[model samples]
Target chain A: MCTTCGCGQGEGRIEGDEHPHVHEDGGGTVHSHAHAHDHAQGPGQRRMVQIERNLLEKNDAFAKINREQFVQKGIFVLNLVSSPGSGKTTLLTATIDRLKPRIPIAVIEGDQQTTHDADRIRATGVPAIQINTGKGCHLDAHMVGHAAERLNLPQDSVLMIENVGNLVCPSAFDLGEAHKVVILSVTEGEDKPLKYPDMFAAADVLLLNKVDLLPYLEFDVDKCLDFARRVNPRLKVIRTSATTGEGLEAWVEWIEVGAHSAKVIRGEALSSPPCRA
Target chain B: MSLMEGMLRIVEENARDQGFGHVRTVILEIGKLAGVEVEALRFAFEAVADGSIAEGAALQIEEPPGLGWCVECEKESPVESRYDPCPLCGKVPLNITGGTQMRVMALDVE
Candidate 1:
């Protein structure tokens, strides 16, 4: 209990203000108000409002709208996340080079401040939009929804969202993608999945990139895979290297499978009206 | 920080709906496996809630322990980390059952 005004319980503290409930009482003496601020409802007629809601409720709502839009458009969206210098862009460019010729491909590049990634994607003969978050760490669904509108995405297309190169924040913000592909490079520690378990847990696929450098470094591939599985049993992993073109074929095939399914679902939806609850 | 913004929005919306003059307390329920830094949220909450209706409102956080259901044991047990095995029987991967939630449970208003 706070010795002072007893405003907060044991844990809560007023940010900058020290004297919480001191009153002069129109006299020279100053005293603190003795109000019951306990776990239960206080006696001072203060109401205890019950509001059991999630912190990401607003973001989740926006993501749901984006998901519906994507499903309706037959757009197979993938949110790619990784640490800085983990070859997210390199892998994306390589994957785009292969998939663009077959399907209508679009890119949404997210970074703190830069049009560099988007420019790189456009050079591949595909439309790409840059979402510079300024000081924001991650790209939210609201931003992606607006970007998708600007892109005017095509049906039976593949939209690859290269998220800001930070594993922590991106895992929390869902962009309504069909799957979240986490890129972990051999250049980094093998224990990355253990250190950042939430990203590994949330990710549907794990792209272990830069596998060409595996022989030179002390990076334990087996240990890395084990740790990733420990965190997420269902994480589909693909050992990839953009430089050597090792796993690009499998990656492209995976995208194709998802895109084909989305197209089929969209066709079915169009043929039959949506069931009303 | 955005989470804090979400928290304030929720409080403000409640205040508008419930006809509350001021919010005196905000109680949050954060789980152990929610991947949120409690200290960071607490430090950021003061600044985020400043000059708003929830300004000076005491922020209280309740952390629920992580729980996982073990296939070998066929029972739920307490866990500290995601990699931890089942306490009863050593299992490689225990299915997560609880403690991944982050929410606002209640508020004290006047």
Candidate 2:
């Protein structure tokens, strides 16, 4: 007899039990016992529990925690995504030189193999860490975790993570960045956004680099901008040429604004949100 | 049939060695650009698990989104292929970020 639900023996007991149970009611008592005959077993009688959990949920959770940590530290972190030789290193060097006197900056460079980019950043007098993702197409939260621990970033500095040069894998794994900046150079065609919509759609800012080479190349700024807009209507596009320092001031200004806003938001003094407002 | 049966036999022996009476469920993470065919994996699972502890176990597959990072812009973009350019930057030679991974993230057992 089960005390809890007060249900009958047949209702409470599961099948294939050998012990017999007696149930008492107002009318009389009923008894049941396990049978000796073999039960008809199906081919696949094992039971399975269906769980609906996203594989990336673990990574996203880590990213959120990192984001909160960045907020607490009052540091603005940007994840820079672009192809190799698109001039990310050059742009970073220039940006660091331009912004160092006013705002302190740090960089975490990811590549398949090389301290070359980090060396370049170090030349600009900024602390940088080179993470070589050998044979791996992307950098995960674990790598970012290690980088954060190794970099010892300042409380108020802007930290940029230069992910491995691949347009596909890094976007799925978030390293807890405040902004995702996509760099498009003039040498690359205008249909890039259409070809890789996912990356464009995920970026907060779209940077059109190598604008100084615009006159020399066949790259159409308007077509590229239009395609990027078509993929991501809210993406902010900034044109820059690291070679001639063209449009770099505007880029620096944008970074400064982002740094200020990040500080305000982290301090809980900003009434409006950083991304939306 | 022989090849599938041999695979199934190996699975049964492995399950028995592992002391699993019956497998409840199996979960797999397949990347979108990982070059793995979902149908092929499913077929293999069915064939190999036919007479093993995983015989009736439910197979669950999850595909996480793909992403790529642009080295030039220092930005990470979501992507679907190795040949796709940076979405934000429109530049080739992108650092591939995600979507080519295969792993068993979880399993349900008795």
Candidate 3:
């Protein structure tokens, strides 16, 4: 009999008093000191099996790969993050229109459910891909990976990823962009950076959108800038109004400079930044 | 967020792959700066786990505080969120060392 399977003890092993035993009446009687070994092994195995950390490690690794790929391609990618109705789409549309006929641009639009922003970008005659995330509040590396496959972006083009209109979830996932451009409209509130600091903290550039509405609304621009700076002192802040095309030229110039810098860093070209936009 | 939900599904699949009949408890490790709400995740787990192996599982969440290394300050500082400035020296551009995570660490099964 196999002792390991609790069958009759092996022929060489007698049903001996050497082993610890538990009675059927729920009372246990230890016959040997070796029983302590079994007690220690159980907790030891548990400690070895338990792992702590985000299971999204795989996604993060993929994001790093995507970032390297983007850098190698010399494409300047910007991840636009903001809340719903924050003028992100409008700003992109205005920027695209201002920079068109000079800068080769493309867009990857992420939304919970809609092709609306993609349609708006397409109207500018630039190639665009609409990623409807369904119920997903954020765009992960996997989704961006799929979008990259579909876009087939030019080696020198500017790729702007308009993340899902969410301040929280989108900030957590890296889409392999060179910069995180966070858009906060004055209509949202001055304390937005403090309320959702992660988004502001992750931002490489902060755009104060819808500044044209500042006069009519009670939104304080200086307070918002001060708060944003406190959260991230190194953050670059740009104020713009998509409606009046205010500050758009500087925005376009910024992208052109970034693209040129990326190209030069990659040894692609010594070409000057586009001057038309 | 659905990312967290998808992560939980993967955990369930992994449990099933191990021949688990049901998952009674799940130990989840979520970083402080992962931008996930523990209570909201628990509610989402309850809703998403319905009819699955995790249907009745109790969600145990562990949140580790965020840690950042400020290049400007040249030291490590503990932070509550990603936005918190360096404690020793108020500065921007702190490199995040840890606490931006979301994962299922362990499970209890019968």
Q: Model 3: per-residue lDDT, tens digit, A142-244? A: 5565467568888877999998888987776778898999999999989999889888888989999998988899998888988887667789988899998
Global fold similarity of model 2 (TM-score) = 0.64
Name model 1 segments beyond 4 Å from true: A1-45, A275-277
> Residues A1-277, candidate 1, lDDT per residue (tens digit)?
3342232321111112243221211110112223322234232458999999988876687688899889999999999999999999889999999998899999988886668889998999899988766556777776677678778899999999998888887898888999999999999999999999989999999999999999899999999999999999999999999999999999999999999999999999889987665
lDDT of 1: 0.82
Ranking by DockQ: 1, 3, 2
Better of 2 and 3 by DockQ: 3
Ten contiguous residues minimizing lDDT sum, candidate 1 chain A: A22-31
- Candidate 1 per-residue lDDT, tens place, B1-110, comes to 76787787788777766777678999999999989999999987998788887999999999999999998788999999888888888886788888988899999998
Candidate 2 C-alpha error for residue B69, in Å: 27
For model 3, the superposed segments whose C-alpha errors exceed 4 Å read A1-48, A268-277, B9-22, B51-53, B67-99
Order the numbered candidates by TM-score, best leading.
Answer: 1, 3, 2
- Which is better, 2 or 3, measured by lDDT? 3
| CA RMSD, predictions in order | 11.7, 18.1, 16.5
Q: Please give the C-alpha DockQ score of model 1.
A: 0.33
